[model samples]
Target chain A: MVEAFAVASGKGGTGKTTSTLALGMALAEEYDVTVVDADTGMANLLFHAGLADVETTLHDVLVEGGAPVEAATYERFGMRVVPCGTSLAAFEAAEPERLRAVVADLAADADVLLLDSPATLGSKSAILPIVLADRVVIVLQATIPAVSDGLKVQEYALSYGTDVAGTIFNRVRGDVESAAEKADRYFEGPLLATVPESEAAQQARAAGRPLLAHAPDSEAATAYRAAAARLDPRDGDSGDVADRFRSAVVPDPP
Target chain B: MIPEGELLRSRVVTDLATALEDVLDRHLDGYAVLAPRETLLGAADGRGVLTFEDGVPACAYHVETDRGGPAALGDVGAGPYRFELYALEAAALEIAHDADELRVPPGMPAERLAGDPALATRTRRRAGVDADRPDDGGALEAFLEDEATVERIRESARREARRRAEEWGLGDALADRPDG
Candidate 1:
């Protein structure tokens, strides 16, 4: 069985890449998780996953007549990671439509697919992960603009018929219980977990490792594990998921 | 209601912390009006009034929502705002400051409105606050309570999504595509 999730936040500075890797690591304990850096334009999952020095990435697989998807895939931190190159030239050369095929290929081999999506909904390419995913897990910071942006992304995902898996309130300080409780009312899913602001999370990024690997004892890591527990990836026929991805209509480049 | 004060400085500022810091540095006794030219939430007419005691925020109010204190801070949207700082006498602000409903924690404005935690800590220190008072999230709670604003955001996003779907050739995937 396989389920694809687009881990998205409408705007940046919400620790989305970190959350993606953290969730992937936590979920990998019980399932075969394939994490893809679907944010081709601003990919940082490589840095967070310690795959920054990999020779091939999603970008290499996305170019016309490019490398096979398997060539870009790596086994890292107990999961399969498809990192994206941080080169402007690679991003410019890569065709966004090829992502559907790549995700379809990965879906066949994994129990769960987590797309580390772009932080914006401005471009078709950026919104593609949300469009293709079975559900979206919105990452949020407890601030006005962050929540507002999260709400907007949720609407876009719902409009395209993607389910709201849940929301993770990241980098939280002080009491956000009341706010998160109230905000949960507007969301279709529960408040999965509130990840506290942690120096370890920042240090993990600097060390080029997932937070679970770098500091499993940290509160943030504990919260991530709880989030993964709450996710409860639904049973989906891998063949059906793969076929859906393969059959998905590719949008025109913006 | 706050008594009118002498105009000290007025300018459009994108960052709210800078204006707050200026007031703190000058140790000004007065109030400031923050009127966003356009809010991120699409509410342009809403404005926040923050009164300062020795440059530390003492009370707050939002003109459009008729909300005061922490809730008013929630009403203050992300800025590129017309910030009008005025100088007022301490005694003149005494009545408004004494209104419990309008009083805000000294650092609440910095933390909630500016999204700057460090600035909040500093402001708390400057105001002689104990620093352990947990933020009740009154501002965000208030923001969530504003159903009209939230609905506007959702409605706008829905329209944008539909329009973008057509533009990007993803109209077939929309939940309610007419042709489908």
Candidate 2:
């Protein structure tokens, strides 16, 4: 069985990359998880996943007649990670639609696939992960823009026939229980976890490691683990998922 | 009600923090009027009125909702909002600022509206030294509880999603596409 989740937020600086890898690491203990940095335009997962030194990446797999998907896949922190390169020329040279086939190929072997999605819903490439995912995990901060943009993301996912797995309130400060309760009313899924802002998360990023791997005992890591537990991964035939991705109708490049 | 001052800035800002941070950094003795850019209630539905003293938030009021203080902050939900900042003499706002019922803590706007904790902390520190106003929380909860505004946000997003789906040629993927 395979379930793909797009860990997404509409706005930036919401610790999306951190939350994605943390969730990926926590879920890895229970399932064979594969994480893909689908945010090709502004790919930073390579830095976070410690794959910054990798010679090949999703960029290589995306360009025509480039590397196979397996070449870019790296086993790190007990999960399969496919990080995107940061080179502007590479990003420009890569084809966005190639992500569909790559995700499909990765979907065939993993029990869970987590797509670290782009922060904006601005372009086809940005929204494609959400459109293709079986479900989305909305990451939010208890502020107007974050929540507002989060609502926009949720609506976009629902409109595209994607289910909302749940919401993770990241970088929370003080008590947000009341706000979380109020927010849960608007979202399709439950409030999975509220991760407090932590210096450990920032330090982990600087150390080029996921929070869970760097500071497993930190409050943020614990919250991410709790979030993973609450995320009830559903059963979907990997063959069907792969075929759907391979056949998913994406618009022609401009 | 407070009297107006000279207009300093007026434009549509996607993030309220830009306006708030500007007000804070400039130490401007002024006020700002924030109105939702897209709303069935129009810009007049409820224009949020926030006053600042030395770039620290002093008081808040929602014109249409007839609510004051932190609740007014809630009335001013997500942006991009039409933000207009007006410069005022400290003497001009002195009396109006005394209305404790209409007062908001220094960091509430940054915290609740901007969702910027760093700005909130800075504002709080500035408030601690510049102004000693009592603090309160729950604007996010208040915004969420305003079912009408929340529904409006969701409704507008849904509309935008479907409209953009067509533009991006992903209309067929829409769950409620006419032909689907």
What is the lDDT of every predicted structure here?
Answer: 0.88, 0.88
Candidate 2, A167-226: lDDT as tens digits? 999988767788888899999998999998899999999999999999999999999999
* Model 1 lDDT per residue over A163-197, tens place: 99999999898898889988898888789899998
TM-score of chain A of each: 0.98, 0.98
Model 1 spans with C-alpha error above 4 angstroms: A247-254, B1-32, B35-45, B52-56, B77-95, B130-134, B177-180
lDDT by residue (tens digit), candidate 2, B1-180:
679799998888987887899899999998998888764356357688999999999899998888888888988888888899999999999987999989887888988788777788889898884332313337788788889888878888888898888998888778974522
Model 1 lDDT tens row, B1-180? 677899999888867878899998989999999887555346566878999999999999998888888889888765667899999999999999899999998987777677667777888888898665545577888888888778777777888999999998888888963422
Q: Who wins the DockQ comparison?
A: 2
Candidate 2, superposed: residue stretches over 4 Å from native: A251-254, B39-44, B129-137, B177-180
TM-score per model over all chains: 0.88, 0.96
TM-score of chain B of 2: 0.89
Pairs of residues at least 3 apart in sequence or in different chains that clash in candidate 2: none
TM-score of 1: 0.88
